[model samples]
Target chain A: MSNFDVIAMALKNLFKRKLRTFLTILGVIIGTASIVVMISLGLALNKNFDSQISQISDITLIHVVGVDQISSQSQGSKNKIKMDDSAVYNFKQIENVESVSPIINLSYAIKAISGKYSATLNLVGIDAQFLETLGYELESGRFLNDDDKLNIVCGGQVPYSFAKNTKRRFYFYDPNQQEKAPDIDVMKDRITISVDMDYGNIDTTGEKSTTSTAKAHPVKFVGVLKYDDFSYSPSDYNCYMTIEQVKKLKAEKQKFDKSSANNNSGFYSDNNSDGYNEIDIKCKDINSVKDIAEKVKDMGYNAYYAGEYLESMRSTAANMQALLGAIGAVSLFVAAIGIANTMVMSVYERTREIGIMKVIGASIYDIKKLFLVESSTIGFLGGIIGALFSLLISYLLNTTNISFFNNDSYIYMSSAAQKPLVSLVPLWLCIAAVVFSGLVGLLSGYFPARRATKLSALTAIKSE
Target chain B: MKNIIELSAIKKIYKMGSEKIVALNNINLNFEQNKIYCILGTSGSGKSTLLNLIAGLEKPSAGQILFKNMHIENFNEEQLAEFRKKYIGFVFQSYNLFPTMTALENVSLPLVFSRVPKKIRIKRAREMLKNVGLENRINHKPSQMSGGQQQRVSIARAFVNNPQVIFADEPTGNLDTKTTFEMMDLITGIARKNNQTLIIVTHDLEISDYADTIIHIRDGVVDEIKNKE
Candidate 1:
């Protein structure tokens, strides 16, 4: 018989017993909906975790520290690895490495003065070309460029670090009253940089040494960086300048210090000539971070990347998804059994009808196909309804502040303040649910359809 | 007259526990084309078994049954179903109409299985129901119709496909005397009008009188064959 006739007959048979068909389909609906909702919940949790982690650090950025520093701190090794311009050039040659920035933390003691507001500043010098690639968000103005002369970029908390010059106390933690942010705008203000000449000086003889005067240089404030509560780098409350400008200032300071000393004993340390203190490497892709970090470590540098932590987090999320999926599978397996039972009962009830059909020229294949179509129709219908119901459940879970997912006691403390969507069902998942349910129905109906085909026409016709 | 179906040395056996019961014993028969034949027997005489074996609904233990020079006894289930679709039709004693369908739909079922288009099958079914005097009740289901009317619908179904041979197993067994005569007349008239072979199995001798030839079956064997014309 034609496929159309088989389907028509199957539909007629199903509609003949409406309540039984509905009940069977309901089993499949519950199965599909539970599976979809459970998996979607796992996906949503993983997404929220990733966003929270991204707020703290750049997952793709790798910090390259001196191997000697790490070995010395950890194992009391005297060996030192120098981080200089050549180190930056070598790191940039690594495969999958996108960009590299050489950083110098200056040892010179300096202070920023804006009217009466003065504060000791932690200064860092870096290549101006890598300012954009460092992943720092600017609050205002622009970062330092190669052409900039004596221009500085300050961190968002730099103004708050200022204090009264006399008492030398931080404005952020004044004991007598609540501290306020200094009235100093880094983007529009002219900041005076005072170089303390007395810094790094110690008298060997038992004589009273006079403190030298501070040399003040007026520098244009360029930009302010965004504040990060959990920054992996020491960018907060620091002033950033180009390496060339910082080198010039250090050279001039060294020359003046040599002139004041009777002997040329006040020279800066020889190790400071190489300029950079550390190197930062940006990878082309987050997945390539681990390989690049390993290559850097092979070169005897200490490499730190967030890819390891991100990988562990992803593995945990995947395990959670699998557990949820397995739980859902159990319900679907039960629904499959229900479908098989319903199909077997249908075959039993339609024995006489099957006999009549056979005697009236219906082939065994046609009879079997009819039963298979009937059962699969139940599955297909149930899957459609189940997917739609899952969408509804997802929306309700996302929109409603359910106690279990949204409570303060939940593990995602960072995302707890803002309501995170607890459930998400994507498009591919809906399609997969329908197709999977239909396949399950087909598998469940196989034995029953076979039994239908094996029925004896002579005996079946005689059945009352 | 040319023979349409020939049966020789046909035997059917049923095993109940360890005992073997011979349902048909060495039955030899030849049914001619365009003729009405009746097999008359009492209950337990194996007339229905003979009919079933001839229809290829049951396989004989030993036989050489041929239809149009092809071996019917050796045909598989699928081949038998194909053969039945092309050459045979049946009217059961219980008027086994699908209760869910109308008379017209019941008549069109064989054609539907034969993969005929819906419009042509329905058109032919309506014509055949009209011929069976069920024109007004074409849309009426079997449960909604009287016993005789349901039987008429069953006869309409058998004739709708216009097969080469028609088998009626106790066609008038459940009808009143007047309705029985009407049913027999309607069935014989259709067969004769179309020159189709007809076989009837009945226990009533009165029903056998309507056939052109009568075979009396006794104790699983043919006792006598009488030709009226």
Candidate 2:
């Protein structure tokens, strides 16, 4: 018999027992939806972690560092150790270590028109070679240059300088007097800044027991800090100047301390004994960062890259994906069982009908295929529904009030240009959902179909 | 006359609790083409067993059954399916029409199994419905029709495929006296018009009046074979 006849007949039979068919299909629906939703959650987590990864560093960029081992039996003896200069030289020799530099951290003041902002300064004293390693783009000014005197670079969105504008507006007057005019921007243009500085040693415990014998430098105002509100980033109030200028101030301070120490030249202990305290090493690609860091650690220093943070973020996303996938898969399994039960019941109810078909020349294979087609159709419908529902749920949660961390206070709202918590479902996942549900239907219906086909025609005919 | 169905020394033994009961004994019978033959017997008299053997629904323990010289007893399930599709049509006492299908759809079932074109099958089914005086009831399901009317639809289905043989198992058993005669006339007329062999298994001897030949079966044995002029 033609396959259509089998399918048509099976469909008719299914329609006859509408509630039973639906209950059976519901099982498959639950199973399919669970699988789809689980996988979808996996995708969502994958996207979230991937975005967080970019926050640490551009995945394409790598970092390199220098180090030295303190002992022969140190933990990382497998790799060679080298000094900062030697490390820089070796990195330069490597074909893929694009650039390298030695850096030092020193404290400095960020001067503004109204006040001075003195925070713990991360004074990254880098040469022109190590500029790319910082991963910061300059918004309006140039980066550090070898020949350009007194020039410095900073992150593109850093708030180092502030600007103000003034405008005029009309003010209301008393009933007995003429209309008055005032410049509203004048009051707002006068910026005020309160500077909190931590000098030599202040006892935070005792109220008035702080002492400072050393002289404090009073900074002058050159510019105000600009506004930068990058999401999740702790703001840095910074000032930019040449590395030479900062070193000169340190040298003068060391000399003044020595002169005041009863003319003892060695008393200051040669403050700049270690010429380079920090370094930002840049490389050709991200894949090399972990290896380079290991090499640097062997040299007796802590080494890391922007890309390491990205790796952590990616791992976080992968874990979340697995969690969601598990949840979805459970439902799909339950649905398959439902489909199996429905087909079995159908076989029992249609025993006589099956016999009639057999007598009218329907083959055993024909009967089997008929039930299989009905089951496949149920799975197909469930898949389509589950896919659409998953997509809708993802969009709703991402756009509305749903938090994975259960922290309503820490909701990350999407601003005008930024995308909302990404609900990304791949095309392959949709296809998988459909095919998987269909296969579940097929498997669940197989045994029942066989049993129905094996029904002896004589007995089936005699059955009421 | 050519023998459309020939059964030689057929035996069907059944085990009932402790005793072995013979549903059909070693009996030989030949059913000719273009003739209506009836096997008349009471309940449990082996008439249905004889029909089943001829339809290839059951196999005899001894001897063989041949349809147009092809031994059906030797054919496998798949082969029997093919045989039924091309050459056999069956009508049951309870009017075994698929309740889900309309009368016309039930009649076209045999044609569908044979992979007949949709247009041609529907047309042939409609013509068969007309032949059985069920033209207006073509779209009604078996549940919507009376017992006699349902049997008529079943007869149309049996004749729709133009099979070599039509087997009716108590076709008029569920019908009233007036409806039984009407149904018998319709079935016999269609079988005669198609020049096909008709085998009717019935307990009602009155309904055998329409048949050209009658075979009396008693206690699994053939008692007599009578031919009317």
> Fraction of reference contacts reproduced per prediction?
0.72, 0.70
Model 1 CAPRI quality: medium
TM-score of chain B of 1: 0.99
Off by over 4 Å in 2: A60-83, A107-121, A133-135, A160-277, A294-301, A306-316, A405-422, B16-19
TM-score of 2: 0.82
Write candidate 2's Cα lDDT for B1-229 as tens digits. Answer: 9888888999999888999998998889998989999999989999998998889888888898988999999988888888888899898898899888899999998888888889999999999999889999999999999888899898888888898899999888788889988888888888888898888999887878888999999999999999988
State each model's C-alpha RMSD to the native.
Answer: 6.9, 7.9
Extract clashing residue pairs from model 1. Answer: none
TM-score of chain B of each: 0.99, 0.97
Q: What is the C-alpha lDDT of each candidate?
A: 0.82, 0.68
Score every model by TM-score.
0.82, 0.82
- Residue B198 lDDT in candidate 1: 97
lDDT, residue B170, candidate 2:
89
Across A102-136, the per-residue lDDT of candidate 1 in tens digits comes to: 77665424656666566666667778877778789
Interface RMSD, per-candidate values to 1 decimal: 0.7, 1.1
